[model samples]
Target: MELSEYCALDATALRELIRTGQVNAAEVETAARQAIESVNGDLNALTQPLFQSALDHDPDGPIGGVPFLVKDSGPFARGVTFTLGSRSIRGAVAAVDHELMTRFRAAGLATLGQTTAPELGLSYATESLRYGRTRNPWALERGVGGSSGGAAALVAAGAVPLAHGNDGGGSVRIPASACGLVGLKVSRGRTPSGPLAGEAGFGLIAEFGLTRSIRDTALLLECVSGPAVGEKYTLSSPDVRYTEVLRADPGRLRVAVTTDAWSGVPVDLQVAGVAAEAARTLEWIGHSVSPATPGIQPDDIVEGSMLAAVATGAALLRAPVRPDPGRLEAVSRALLAETLAFTALDVMAALDAQNRLTRAVGTFFTEYDLLVTPTLAQLPARHGELDYDDPGYSMRDWLRRIYQYGPFTAAFNVSGNPAISLPLGQSREGLPIGVQLVAATGREDLLLQVAAQLEQAQPWAGRQPSVFAG
Candidate 1:
């Protein structure tokens, strides 16, 4: 298959082609490898390319024979180097496949390699001492939102149709907005979290993927979603297939639109206008739309997210793969120091804050079926702007900076609500602007329904970045 042909086909389209022998698996895989080679140098995507594994992958799963990239910071594949974008931990490899990784294999995805993430996924930008900045394809000088930055760039640039990424404090959605992709942070308890442990980041982390289209997003969810054995979370899969859900009407949804950040962070007017326009479009679609903001304190999210970082950092440090202090970056050193300083009671208070915010946001959802906000507060920032190496910051400070840049996203992450970022608008500079649609917990089915409708109403297929797979 030609690179242009491979890039043009989405996961669903490519699967059908291979399934019918119109295209062979190897041909698609080769195209993907070449695509990566063609763009990886400029985008700094793909931490490691495991293209050889494409040969032996199972060919009998839904969406099978599709090229996929896993985030370097997550869902460890057995024997693959699970560098959390850190220079430390020499020779550390995943001893077992995470439940998600197993599901990825079972779903017939050819794991091409790992994409870049921020060190420990702490920052909202994918720049670290381990792997340098992952540049946005939209504009080469801009940053790809982290820590799923590289995955988003790859998918956005059409190197692959879909790539695995997880969100805890907007990692997936942030990058999605920045890269103009479909990113969904599944609700808490909706996916697996065990085998090595029972839970993650005190239920803030939601493992999912990013894609170029809503149909691909819906299809991928059907392929890899569902709880595994001993997993901490267990939500029912879409009652019907998500692709089927996409076919139906979303039906008279009451949507709340907010240009004002609940965290009191500033939202750029251009980004806010795009969100406002999305609200208007929803109203035009026969849905009720109104301006509203969740009643919550900024500290609730900042504190809760920082505490989760503290917990995740503590766990990683205590594990056998602990990094040598000398090998750690300044930001990481500051993170560890901050983690050591935190008292257990402070963590309890953080949990209390999480509970309070979750309850407050959940209360807001009672009146509104959906919440629309800018997926990012500003446009994709220039590269080197979200500096991770600065030792002057603690985890809380870092959280504040990143969250302020994307105030709306973390609230949903902490609330455990399902949120999707769609590329619905473009800036005057031609950069894609993402509008986030958030649904109550475990409402991914509804998210897809509305997302598909929006995708149909205002198609983004005609737009491509300055740098694309072709």
Candidate 2:
């Protein structure tokens, strides 16, 4: 098959082709290389190519012969270099495959390359002083959201059907929304973060993928969703496959739509309108939608978490990854310095606050099965729009910038719930607008159910960016 023809098929379809003997793993890999050569000049998404490794060993499973990519950050890929979007760690190679990569191999998905991430995935956009920037497939003028920006871009451009993405604070979903794909942030510990380090963002986050289709997302989750050895936490898998849930109808359930941010920031009108449109679609599909507010108390949760995150961010300055002095951007360095200024007591206080916030969200889910809201308060940001180049800014100001752009996502990290950003609508300006679907802790089944229904109703798979459509 031609490169464009291979890129056009979803992972499932590709697998079917391979199983039916119509295509082979070598052909799929060739197609991926050709696709990358054709599309990556405009996107700058792939950080390291693994075509040789994939060709050397092709396993058989659910996604066998399907080409894919992993985010440059999080865990380790054996023999492949992982820069994590920083110049500091350039040329570093993984000594062993992370457990999730092991699962990807078992599933028969060929990981032909690594995708771009923000420097250390510290911020929400994929622009890095180290690697330049990852441009959105929809518009070169705008950024693809970081730190999974590369994965989102490749999937959006049809270079590959699914790619690895991990969300600490909306990294996966942010890029997914910005580039128009399905990004799922699995419940913390629901997906293993091991074979190198145990947890990241102090267990406030989890890893998964940004996929062009919900079924691809579901299949990827199945392949890599269980806990690995030495993990402190693990969630029970559903009795039936998540793809099975997609095949069944998502019966009427209570759905809540909220446009208000916990920090009192107003959602952009276009984003809110997109969420409303999704709500109407749910109603048309036999689900109930009503205005709902989170049950959590709003007294300093966002601020407190930001302060705590500062301490965690500070710890990364001394991280074991190959240090790329002068490789990271000034914003990351400034943020790290700010985190270092905090006392150990401050971090403890933040963890306590995180517990309280978790309890509050847990209480809310008792009444509502899902919460629907704008994935981002604003549309995709311009390149360097959230840059912290000003030396005069305080850590508090930096935190404000981060929180203002990503208020709703971090809360779910603390709560350790599964939430997804679905590219259900587009802004009048032609930017993608992702609507969030959040589920209770360990209840990904319900979340997938809702996603499958919405996916069918709106059908984002057929919608492609102009670059790829041609």
Candidate 3:
């Protein structure tokens, strides 16, 4: 098969082809390699390409011999290069396969490569010191949001149909929103993470993937979710598959819409317009939508959660072969330095704020089944907008800018609730604008139900970027 044809098929279609012996896993692997070689130069989204392992794997398998790519920010495929976009650990290879990745392979996904990420998955935009910048597929000058930014860019560019992503603080959703893909941050503990690691950033987050199709995302989650042996916590699974839930009627949902950030920060006009359109789309589908704010003290909580996140960042700096504290970008180094100011009590305080904010949002969900908001307060910022170039601002100011821009997503993570970013609208600049649909903790089924309805209302599945149009 031609690389173009192989790159075009979604995971299910590829698997069907494999099962029918129309194509072999090796051919798919070659196609993925060729695609990466052809486009990665312009994008800089790939960190490691594992073509040989894919050739050695099964062809007529579940992922149907489809080639898959993973984010380089996290520890996943064993013995693979994992540089979380830092110059410090330029060629660090993981000692073993992370548990979630094992599940990916078991489900018949052939691992052909790894994608780029922001440094330590810390930034929202994916301009890393190690690999330079991962450019957006739609518009090269704009950034793909980080952590999962490269994965999102690759999927958006048609380099791959689905790629792994993990959300600690909107990492998955941020890129998905920016790139116009279906990015689901599954409820915490919904998927097993083990062997190589257990629980990320103090159980504040977990990892998953980004896909062009809701069905592909739903099926990927179905394959990945469920408690692993010896897991500290697990969520209750629905009796039916999430894909089925997508087709199922969501019933009448009371969805609360807020154009403003939870902290009362005004949203960019285009961002708000996209979110309002999504609300209108919900109304078109018989759902009740209204302007209502979820109660959150954005400042108080942002400080605390940020401490936790920066503390995680600090730990990475203190990891063996620490980046030349000087070599580290000014912004990231400042963040790590600020984390040093936190005491154990400070971490506890952050945890307390997280719990309180989670509870406050939970109360809103008690009255409203869903909360809808712009995935970000603004469209994807130009490259270097969030970079550490301005060393004058303290770390807190830098973090506040990020918080104000991304207030909606972190709350769901703190609450351990499920949220999905649907690419239902676009900015005037032709950039994709995503609307977030959040459900109560463990209510992913219902969230998918609403998303599926939205998908049908304004079908965006075929809206590929120019690169992917081939």
Per-model C-alpha lDDT, please?
A: 0.86, 0.77, 0.78
Provide C-alpha RMSD values for all models, in order. 1.3, 2.3, 2.1
Q: Please provide, for model 2 over 1-470, each residue's C-alpha lDDT reduced to its tens digit, 9 standing for 90 to 100.
A: 87667877888888888889998877877787777767888988877554565622345787877887888874466777777677766566778887777777788777778888777776777877666788888988889887788889888988888888777777788888889988899997898877666666677657778787888888888888877888877787888888787787657888888878888877899998988888889888888888997766444455444643563465466667535435456766666666667677867777777778888888888988889988998998888787745455565666567668766776787778899999999988788999999988888888888888888788877777866722
Clashing pairs in 2: 64-108, 88-324
Candidate topping TM-score: 1
Compared with the true structure, model 1 gives a TM-score of 0.98
286: Cα error in model 2, Å:
2.2
Better-scoring candidate (lDDT), 2 or 3: 3
Best lDDT among the predictions, by candidate number: 1
lDDT comparing candidate 2 with the true structure:
0.77
- Measured with C-alpha atoms, the lDDT of residue 168 in candidate 1 is 89
Model 1 segments beyond 4 Å from truth?
Answer: none
lDDT for model 3 comes to 0.78
Question: Candidates ranked by lDDT, best first?
Answer: 1, 3, 2
Per-residue lDDT of candidate 3, residues 1-470 (tens digit): 78768667777777777788898766766777777777777777887555466623344445756777888865667777776777766667777777788788778777778788877777788887778888888888988886799899888887777989988878899899999999999987898767644566766667789988888887888877888887776886889987687788878889899888767777889988889988998888899888897788876556545744765676676677666666666676777777777677877777888878778878988999998999988888789887744677576676677766676787777767889998988888889888998988888888888887788889996677755524
Return the TM-score for each candidate structure.
Answer: 0.98, 0.93, 0.94
Write model 1 residue lDDT over 1-470, tens digit each, in one string.
98999998789999999999998988998899999889898998877655466523567888788999888864388877777888885577778888877888888999888899988888788887777888899999899898899999999999999998989899999999998888999889877776676878888888889998889888878877887777777887866988899898878999988888877778899999998988898899999998887897999988778756886778766886567877887778888887788888988899899999999999998999999989999999887788888878877888888877888888777788999999999999999899999999889999999998889888998788988988
